[model samples]
Target: MALPTSPPEPARLAGDNWLANCAEWPDLVRQAWRVEALGTIVTGTRWLAAEAPLVVVLAAMKRIPHAELGPVLADPTVEKGWWLVPLDAADHLSDIRQLRVRPPGWPLRCPPTGWQLCGRFWLQPPDGSGLVTAPPLLGAALGPGGPRLPAEAFG
Candidate 1:
């Protein structure tokens, strides 16, 4: 799904579907970063904060063509931060399930750090409505090497 170049309206997703407000997009991105950082630290991996990958989330009901997503995933313009992947409903659910499972040597559950950890994928809209101009869907963080989808986030 090709999102509009400009931000969309708030009422666009007002139904019972999960939606992330445009205002909170930054926070969501930050949370994803924190999750990545925490994961690396806990696992004893090298902490390369500046070299963190971008998070890509597939938020739409239909899966985005790999041709389209591939380019975005491989895009070199995005140095650091998370980006939406735009997957279909089925794929989104699958991805979420994969993310929820804690990896070996990782914490069983995310700590109460207030920041939504890896397994915690859903983001509540500020107004408790549908998504807004910026919808927080399944995304992956991009770093120097490649895209890092939220995984082993809790641990």
Candidate 2:
């Protein structure tokens, strides 16, 4: 199965307006992006790479406010997760061992906002507001092992 370098001008999505305008996601509306050999050329924002478990740990932790949650993509095959953070997030996440701030112009496999295409799924779908995980908080929560959640975690 050939994944699209771009999905067919993705059908009207919930955050299309913001993605198209605010986020400046290139070719989001005009191009025909489909699951092919490659995915989308994510622009205007940056990404953080980590294991799926750690990403899940961060999402489930009560300490990390729900509002802080942003767009997260999960690759079941690799059990890896991709987080859409502010473009400058690298400065904050670079120090963390469990996470790697993707370099500029990174190509992430973003299938869409609301569906799991192929093995990629959105753990936290984009909402158009463009608010993503707070890097500082993410850094503080991460440890050599993984997220240091409070006693009552994964809620």
Error of 1 at 8 (Å): 2.7
How do the residues 1-155 of candidate 1 rate in per-residue lDDT, one tens digit apiece? 11122112442233111222222243453354444422122211211011123233323212332323311111123422222222222233234322321222332111112223333321221122321211123222111233343467757
lDDT of each: 0.25, 0.56
Residue 91, model 1: Cα distance from true site in angstroms = 13
Worst-scoring 10-residue span by lDDT in model 1: 43-52
Worst 10 residues of 2 by lDDT: 2-11
Q: Please provide, for model 2 over 1-155, each residue's C-alpha lDDT reduced to its tens digit, 9 standing for 90 to 100.
A: 42323322443364444443433455653242343322364554534433335455444443455677766667777767866677778777776676777776655655555445567766666676666777765665564443455666767
Model 1 steric clash total: 29
For TM-score, the strongest prediction is: 2
Cα error, residue 26 of model 2, in Å, equals: 3.8
Best by lDDT: 2
TM-score of each: 0.17, 0.65
